[model samples]
Target: MTISWLYIGIFLVVSLGLPAVAIILAGILAPKKPSPEKSIIYECGVDTHGETWVQFKAQYYLIGLVFLIFDIETVFLYPWAVAFDRLGLFAVLEGLLFIGILTGGLVYAWKKGAFEWA
Candidate 1:
């Protein structure tokens, strides 16, 4: 147990320390140069005219999250489907339950106007 903990501790330290050391090294080794052109926000090689920080509608993110959730359903379902013959009745019920829950979530999102474009 102690050895396992020691390994975990070492792993954590190395994982964290490596990135920190790299960033510190970069800061120390990189050139200290600043200019107006460098500071200004450049988009598609053109100067930005309006405010850079534009607020996006929450619906965009909500729709994206919905897509992500459904997409992940395929990942879980595909394997279960491939092995359906071996898995028998229990797996079928479990898969049905999972689909039912996701369907309920989709219906809820639809009712909330998450699919609306405008």
Candidate 2:
């Protein structure tokens, strides 16, 4: 019992102490330079031309959410398709229902002008 506790104590000490040690060592050994160019925001090596926060239409977020919902629906369908033989008709019906709900959501989003892209 005490041996198990010793292992746990060692584990706790190592996990907690390792991060502090790394930070202390880095603080001591790391470079102490702050150049103006080094502090600039990076964007794939291309120079930033304008303001960072631009006005975006709410439709963009709605379309993104719709894509995410459909993407998740596809992910669920793939696993269900793999085990489809074992699950038989019940799984098929469930999968169909999931697709139906996602399709309905897509149609609703279309009606709400989410796909306008303007």
Candidate 3:
């Protein structure tokens, strides 16, 4: 009974009190000043130019998403391959199915013009 309460107390102290103390100390010690030069956006110690938001083609995101999907799906094949000897035909069939699905996705993306550089 007392042991559980002790653990609860410890958890509360570590999670809540420690963070509160650190934040309060930092706020008290930190400088609070703003100037025109410091207010501007700084990138690589150079003045930033133009609007931060820029228009992008949907094809760029489509290609990136397709690459990610295929890349992650392909990694699963490695573990399946390693266990192929033990799993026999089952692993082979499963891997083929997985590859077939991703290949279909690849075909769809290709047909949709995801692979085009322009």
Q: What is the lDDT of residue 59 in candidate 2?
A: 77
Q: For candidate 2, lDDT tens digit of each residue in 1-118?
A: 9999999999999999999999999999999898999988888788889887989888768877888988977987887888877896877897899889988988898888888877
TM-score-superior candidate, 1 or 3: 1
Most accurate candidate by TM-score = 1
Query: Mind giving the per-residue lDDT tens digits that candidate 3 earns over 18-91?
Result: 88999999999999798988888777688777877879888778878987998899898899878888986876
Clash-forming residue pairs, model 1: none
Runs of candidate 2 exceeding 4 Å displacement? 1-50
lDDT of each: 0.92, 0.87, 0.87
Q: Which lDDT tens digits does candidate 1 get at residues 1-118?
A: 8999999999999999999999999999999899987987668788777777899898889988999999988699998989989987987999999999999989999999999988
TM-score of each: 0.54, 0.52, 0.53
Off by over 4 Å in 3: 1-49
Superposed model 1: Cα runs more than 4 Å off: 1-48
Candidate 1 achieves a global lDDT of: 0.92
Worst 10 residues of 2 by lDDT: 56-65
